[model samples]
Target: MIRLRTVEGDPPDVDALVGMYADFEADDRAQGIPPIGTDLIRGWLTGLEGIHVVADHRGEPVGHAVLVPVDGETLELAIFVHPDYQGATIGTRTLGELLDCGAAADATAVELHVERSNDAAIALYRKYGFTAEETRSMELRMRRPLVTPPVA
Candidate 1:
């Protein structure tokens, strides 16, 4: 089972998050920039609500995700599953939880900038209902409508 929680900032899993992101960035050198250290990752996490969710198996962290709010109405999301857990649906579940939280907070939409070369992520986002609205350089801007509350 996949369990998710809204982590405010700097959870114990921050190290894991940083490691995965840094590794991914290293693997794709031209995709923006790689996180150099914990300090930078912490600084980035500090600016937003830092929604972090972990999927555990037998009390071990196997997958993790983070959603950084871009503004009042937009958010940037990233997820990483340990190579051992890559084929599972942890990423999908994490994305769903983030969207639910954003909708609950009255956000109208969420957006993410993903490198076009990252076909797996692009495909995953599209599977989760995100639409590619534009592209710049090697990055693609994807957007998804947040579920809105009914008019009172």
Candidate 2:
């Protein structure tokens, strides 16, 4: 069974998460993420401040999703699932739960940039209501509204 847990303002098993990245092949990377080494991975992980959700399988973290604040009230989304764990519908569950997490935190909306050629990722985002707003440097910038407009 897969379990999703929120990691907000809390430290997670950084090593396991980083290891998942290391296991990814060159072709599996999106936007040059997961870095390359332990130090770079740790650096990237440490630099973010926002909501994180991890998918635990049995005892190890098999996937990760994060929502980092971009502009005030808007968050940028990113998700990575270990290569071995891909195609099991884990990405669907992880991202869906993260959106729930975002709504709980009162996020105005969530945005993500995915590789233009990554149809699978784009489809996943589209499945959750993210619309492609623009394309820049081979990446598609997508956004999904999470909160209602305040009474004006």
Candidate 3:
């Protein structure tokens, strides 16, 4: 079973996540992400700021999603699922949880850049209401508005 949860104040288990990325398939990369080496992956993960969620199976991370602030009211979103865990709805659930976290944090919008060739990811983003904002070379930019809850 896969369990999903937000990463709170404490830092995430970087080594475990690195291990997961290490096993990531090269063909699965999009827009040059999930970096390419141990140090690069660690640097990228540690430098990210904002909400993070992890999908764990048997206490090991198999997927991750994040909503990083682009400004006060907007955020940039990214998600990745280990190849072994793809096509089983983990990406969909992880993305839903990440968006929920973004809405709860009061973000007004979220954006992402994906390779134009990544049809599966683009379809998933569109399913969640993201629309194409621009196309730059091999990448496509997409954005979606988040509806925050009413203030009490």
lDDT of each: 0.71, 0.87, 0.87
Query: What lDDT is reached at residue 65 by model 2?
Result: 86
lDDT of 2 by residue, 71-142 (tens): 888999998889888897888998988899899888889999999998988998998999999989799999
The CA root-mean-square deviation of candidate 1, after full C-alpha superposition on the true structure, stands at: 3.4
Question: What CA RMSD would you report for each candidate?
Answer: 3.4, 1.6, 2.7
How would you encode candidate 3's per-residue C-alpha lDDT over 57-119 as one tens digit per residue? 999999988888889999998888999988978889989988888888888999999889989
* TM-score, one value per model: 0.74, 0.93, 0.91
lDDT of 1 by residue, 1-152 (tens): 65565665555565655565455435643344345666776665454356677777665666666667788777777776766677788878888887787777677888888888989889989988899999998899899988655899
Query: How many Å off is the CA of 132 in candidate 2?
Result: 0.8
What would the TM-score be for candidate 2 when compared with the true structure? Answer: 0.93
Q: Between which residue pairs do clashes occur in model 2?
A: none
Lowest summed lDDT window (length 10), candidate 3: 5-14
- Decreasing TM-score order of the candidates: 2, 3, 1
Question: Which 10 consecutive positions of candidate 1 have the poorest summed lDDT?
Answer: 25-34
CA shift of 146, model 2, Å: 0.5
